[model samples]
Target: MGSDALSPEVAARERTLDDLRRRMASVPGRGESATGHIPREQPLRRDLLPVPGPLAELLPDGGLPKGAVVAYSGAHSMLSGLLAAVTGDGGHAAVVGLPRLGLLAAAEMGAQLSRLAVIADPGPDPAEVAAVLLDGLDLVVLGLGDLAVPPARCRVLAARARNRGATLVVAGGTWTNPSLRLDTRVTGYRGLGAGRGRLRSVCLDVRVSAKAGPPRHGRIDLCAQAGRTEWLAREAETREVVDLREAVS
Candidate 1:
């Protein structure tokens, strides 16, 4: 009875994947979907230049959303670098009001000069910059500081991106309107050297909270080189669904 509820959607996705497998089966480095394994198609081509960051490669889609705002933490430099790489590839990207961001470091990660715009103005208005950035670019990167705007505007940007197939990466706080909210956790870190060494490297654990579909969560491992990102699937773990309406007591 429980499996019956999921038959239609699961069957449809399976059929689609089976068809895709048949077409791409001859391709190298690609493997077949094992028994009981759910097939999920990666959004972007995995071969495009990898971004600089340890966790960029581990993301399920191989990168961030091409048209949705993803709120994140300021502590993870690797995460920010990954976002910049996504925006700076083949399209113009705007980094708004993130004064603390090291543009040089981002560039070192993989941000392209011709496709990057860094807006350092610390103004009270977010809509102004958001409007301009949204209109003239394929991607928008904003640092959500202590802003006083309503969530509706964020929703509007999300809707626009979804409609236009553009991607937005929002850092520094919780974005309620995201199609997927990515929460990162550090699994392990390496050492470059002593005293002057950088964050040797780190792994990322992701918890994706979605607005509609079933919330997906998992962990991934990644390593950052001078300007390349490598992602590896660690373990695809299932999450427990708690009913919000149910009483805790």
Candidate 2:
């Protein structure tokens, strides 16, 4: 059937895909070689996207690797921080199937809302929507919910992200063989004491495991105040002094 005869929703999806393609075409040197082929080995900068400073320390490359699929599990704030960092760095990003994502929090974290796209409902097949977005966006975040995507489909999406020089982040699903996996949890909170002060910051414990290396762990503080957000690294543990004389006596 012709596009003109399609339903309004379908036509709108088609239009969005077309617009993404056009935008990608206008950009230059997205890991493309002189022969118009995407090179496997992109330069250092082009091979990765900027991430928040605290999160960067957990990754091997100090950034989110381009052309790779990463699985994130844990606090949703981590994802928000990622969106903020990527968009704030002048890169385009899209979130699929996450209607509750706090764009206001992302903005406070320094995200460029104009460069970010949110597809609250991707009409059942969110992976497909994410694939189309990968063609143009610098980062594509897909929320998988309880659906267990087949390994084959995941591979295809990974390859597409690689060819397009985009990063794919899968959240809340069973995706096999991602390049990296990050697990995070809330460790503590700060700025509230004596039942009087307002909440200001949260501490998260982040665990990063990649394909080739041992897992790395770190703590980070997500601070929001005065219409701005900041990610700050925290010491993994605090030291306490011990006196041996008391025990021995």
Candidate 3:
């Protein structure tokens, strides 16, 4: 629905209500009402907003699978903290060789600053950073950059995560390293016309496949600037479906 459909007064009122609901959801230590009869105020946990329909069913936790690697290309900035969000609250995470990301933005995305560690400015070989990641973290985020890491290293990293129950996220660089993979691409929808204000949105198309699990695929609309990441059912035609042949082999 267009924002113009409602009168300015109504729109203002709706926005106020939205803000109040969001604030109430954010209150700390505010559990169910003292009587214990009130329905729990939105299950208390720090999960990612929600998963897209098709992919959600495939995940055991209705989110990204724990202790597995999910990859993204050209949209790292857009889908930051994917691992941490999927890992839930109080989860530990590490970022390797991510030289360009804004640390504050990282914090905003969900990785706790106290729980996060960074391996900055590493050499071209990603294996070096991968080794530290495999040994240290419960969840690891890595940027490929110029590194041409061997396929064997990716396999080993995935195995270590599986063995230790960690989640590995790869973004903005090389892919094609493991038995399972998730490839993502972002498409931006532009707002049109002169009378209406410009409204923009990004759709993240995800293709996820695992050796034993079903080859699942879907697209989720994500709000980048807004703190909330909600699932969008209807949208423009910019989303794309990726073929898994290359990733599976």
Candidate 2 error regions (>4 Å):
1-44, 236-249
lDDT of candidate 3 over 42-143, digit per residue (tens): 332233223344446444456655466766555554445453343234444556677676666555556456555665654455444555554535566777
Runs of candidate 1 exceeding 4 Å displacement: 1-63, 192-199, 212-214, 218-249
TM per model?
Answer: 0.58, 0.81, 0.58
Clashing pairs in 3: none
Best by TM-score: 2
Instruction: Please list the Cα RMSD from the true structure of every candidate, rounded to 1 decimal place.
Output: 18.5, 7.8, 17.8
Clashes of 2: 0
What value of lDDT does candidate 3 attain over all alpha carbons?
0.53
lDDT of 1 at 56: 47
Candidate 2 vs candidate 3: the TM-score winner is 2
The residue-by-residue lDDT of candidate 1 on 80-146, one tens digit each, is 5664555444444567778777766666556665456666662555444555555545566677676
The better candidate by lDDT, 2 or 3, is 2
